[model samples]
Target: MTVGQRSGPPIPLLGVEEEFLVVDTDRGEVVPEAATVVGRARPALGTRVGGEITKLQVETRTDPCQGVDDLHGQLVEGRAAVQAAALSAGLRVIASGSPVLGRAVPPPITEGPRQDRGTATFRGLHDELAICAVHVHVEQPDRDRAVLIGNHLRQHLPALLALTANSPYWPERDTGYASWRSVTWGRWPVAGPPPFLTSARKYDEHVDMLLDAGALVDQGTIFWDLRLSTNHPTLEVRVADVPLTAAESAALAALVRALVVVAGDAVDGGDEGPELVPELLRLAYWRAARDGMGGHGVDVTTGRLLPAAALAERLVALARPALDEAGDGERVEAWLGWLAADGDGATRQRAAAALRGRLTDVVDEIVAQTAPNVPMSEESTLA
Candidate 1:
């Protein structure tokens, strides 16, 4: 197929997908109650939030938003609806990438055709693949631009991962790794930063190969860190774990919007960015998987070693222009400050668990973070 240049208004928009674990508030154990919550929230579905692969997972997508303020409102409203539904079902939602309950025997498949197929495919790959993630999708002008943006964005994946790391404990065990969700996702054949694509045509060719090999059903099945959306004119970043709070999730989405604007502009202007070798990108991804924000450092372009803090500083500097250009600099900076000070949700949850000697406290923290009006002390009753 002949590839054409992307065509549309250059306005960048943002959408978010957050997955949460359903747990009994008192027991702090996983419950197959997501359906109940989702059912209760049906009147708000599509208008606010939606369901995901398992009975324990739910996802929220913001209405296409042009700025951080709109994004924030959508997130707050969506999460409120989900939390209310969960409360009505006598369940509390846990937002960590991997729940504290660990991997239980695969629950019976949820009711959708796509989810059923996804479950079957996942079961074929690993025995324990019950982790959750937050996928951020940013609209591009068209498919070609989406492909180009995905390619240029690959080098920065590690930086974004470091900032969003939230899954420290996995399977009820303290995994020293920062984001155990990365480890779980790595089990998939095509689940990391994608190899470079020279052009949109080449990307299509690669997708065709995967389909021919029976590795994927279609373009939607290509689960790379960056991929052209099969249904929308957007590039989706699927690297980060599900955040523990709606604020964190919104912050990540804002950053993604800024990154996409920068990359899309570079491609649109025919100024393909500084060539970042694939090997370096791969190594950087490994560093993100292993140390998260706590890791030493990453050379996004050269793949050389550096301290994680230093790398974060560099990324903030690099992204400042983009954030400013997109008029979201203030919000992005605020979010970064929160990440640096409190550490990511995973780090905070692990520390709280260690200090209190109970997973219930961690769950309570998540609940408090998710519901803005609910006081922390009241939320702690769950603990």
Candidate 2:
């Protein structure tokens, strides 16, 4: 069945999909626990968390909401539920894009058709690639806007990467990249920024051409950096890696919402900020993937190279108007400042690892930093 066009008012909404690793706390190894975790959280099953390829990973999605405040609450509740359930099942939830201590072992595919297809397809593509990510979806008024935002947002993707750079250590060693997960994920055939689709009709035509050529089974296979969701009325931005904490996740979501509102307003005003050719965008993405925040940057429109931090500053300046328009300027600035000060997740993780000399210690720090507070029950009595 063909996916229908997006239907909604111009009011922006936010949804977050966070992929987490199931870790054995004692050994610091990846373990397959989809059945155990999903079984235990049956009541909250499908409502908050769901299974992903390889039982080692699980993903939780927040219900769609109109504002960041509500979105934050959903994230907190969902994360709390998942953490409690995971702890109960002898597993711990980790927020890194790729776990540092896990060995690559293919886990059984839990019963489902789409998941089965995904597992088979990925296994055929590459081995030793079990990474997780956080995908953010924002509701678009229509498909044309979705396509436009998808293209324009490509320029700002690096800045987002700099902010959400988790997963420095990979496979028990320092990958020497801020977000190795980004590199690992790029192995997929259709991953990365998509070719510009100017309108809904153009996007549909591209999908049709791919299907006609037997390139894909359906829209589900088109894993662009940003794309219209196959089953939802939202544009999915799969750029940022999963962060280590719910606050970080919410911060990333807030940035995404701000971008959509900014881009949507620009489109509505007939101001297409600047033209970015495909090659230039690719180079920028490559640099971001390579050096992350420490890498060179590319001009969004002209493709001229610049320092990554300078480009990030320019992006923040460009986004200021939109943040102000959305009345979220303070929050956005604070979030960006945190990233700048801490130097993204990759840098911080490396620092922790270097200081502590243990990858598990780094993971423990991430968990402690990101986990939500558990309130004490009022009726509890001391033994």
lDDT for residue 106 in candidate 1, whole number 0-100 = 63
Candidate 1 Cα outliers beyond 4 Å, as residue runs: 1-9, 102-105, 112-122, 273-277, 374-380
Screening candidate 1 with a backbone cut-off below 3 angstroms (N, C-alpha, C), the clashing residue pairs are 102-171, 296-307, 296-308, 297-306
Model 2, stretches more than 4 Å misplaced?
1-10, 44-46, 105-112, 119-123, 126-129, 271-275, 374-383
| Model 2, position 287: C-alpha lDDT score | 70
Cα lDDT, all candidates? 0.73, 0.72
Work out candidate 2's RMSD over C-alphas.
5.3
Q: How well does model 2 score by local distance difference test?
A: 0.72
Across residues 74-146, which tens digit of lDDT does each residue of candidate 1 receive?
7777777777788876777777787776344464446867766665665555345556788888876467667
lDDT of 2 at 80: 67
Across 1-383, the per-residue lDDT of candidate 2 in tens digits comes to 11112332344777889888777757667778856776676576465778876677778888887666677777777766666677776666778888778675443455678765665555655454467788899887588878887767877886677667787777788877787887877777677877766788898898888767655656788877788999788889888888877777887777787677667777777664455677777777767766677667676677787877787667767777555655556776776677768777777778777875887777666655555564323221111
Cα-based TM-score, every candidate: 0.90, 0.88
Cα shift from native, residue 325, model 2 (Å): 3.3
Model 1 residue 96 CA deviation in Å: 0.8
lDDT, candidate 1, residue 182? 83
